[model samples]
Target: MAVTVLSVNAQQRGNRENMTPEKMAERMTEKMTEDLKLDEAQKQEVYDLNLESANKRTEMMAKEQTDKKAARENMKADQEAHEAKLKEILTNDQFVKWEEIQKEQREKMKDRRGGGGRPQ
Candidate 1:
């Protein structure tokens, strides 16, 4: 659910930096709906899952982390769980496509940021 819009539509948002969790979830869900051909129920499920995940991430980001490695591990674990739920919701082809999209987006982010992004 909280796929990070993977940075809130960097191209169109332009100078803007920070979007509320709800907005981020909406945008992420919209992208999934378009790319994955999600039905109404799936969209709602994805939205709720995304909103919940984003809210948790927002809170996690606000806290100070003394160990970045631990934080990254935790994030990875959560993402795995999210992906499991998503797999249950999507068809096999859709899930594969979703992973491809995520990988492509990650590559785009790395290109934009000079290789600054967490590894999966």
Candidate 2:
């Protein structure tokens, strides 16, 4: 059930990024009606909810992406400023753990891309 909700949340985000509002609504309606077996009223409710969530996530992701891009651009400058501090702060083990966590996150994203269906 949790996975299904998360999948819906991700789908909402993808719809926001990939399609226009009208198309997103139409697609959501179709999915709710056909795939989820929802009725007209339920579909409308779901569509509205999804659309609202999508808008919020889209804004947040856009902000995050912008922030990330800026951060990347400043990496060299920041590294020059903070490399010594970073090395003092994080030991080799911590860096290794960070890499592992990033790998796990990438795997989860890959699963989401693959429809987020039941595990095979």
Candidate 3:
């Protein structure tokens, strides 16, 4: 009984892993066709467009992520420089306000990290 269960589980896992990208694309196309009210010609056109869009999106997302990473590094360097300047410029009372502002900015960024907050 245990052997049978193990075999079945292994087969299921293999089936899942064996799914081709073409099959996945076909399934996605079917879903999109249903949602978009696509006729046969329209479906083909939309599928082609969607595939193109998906490729473009993938490329753009990768580049955007790279840019974001680089920008974040630059911002960190800038923030460090700015903080040093601020420390030199601000009195004790002004420094307290600066700290509060930093705290607020952190809270705002935390809310935005998951895409629920305002535009970055």
Alpha carbon lDDT of each predicted model? 0.85, 0.57, 0.59
Q: Go through the candidates in order and give the C-alpha RMSD of each one to the true structure.
A: 7.1, 17.0, 18.7
* Most accurate candidate by lDDT: 1
lDDT of 1 by residue, 1-120 (tens): 345674666545753336788988899999999999999999999998899888877777778988888888878888888899989888899899999999999999889878876564
Q: After the best TM-score superposition of candidate 3, give how far the Cα of residue 12 lies from its true spot, in angstroms.
A: 50
TM-score of candidate 1 relative to the true fold: 0.77
* Model 3 regions more than 4 Å off: 1-67, 112-120
Predicted structure 1: clash tally: 1
Better model by TM-score, 1 or 2? 1
What lDDT, from 0 to 1, does candidate 2 have? 0.57
Candidate 3's TM-score reads: 0.35
TM-score of each: 0.77, 0.38, 0.35
Task: Check candidate 3 and list the clashing pairs.
Answer: none
Q: Identify the superior model by lDDT, candidate 2 or candidate 3.
A: 3
Residue 28 local lDDT, model 3: 57
Candidates sorted on lDDT, descending: 1, 3, 2
lDDT of 2 by residue, 1-120 (tens): 999998999998776678765666577557545644555665666566556544544455456565665655555444344334323434466445644655677788878779474453
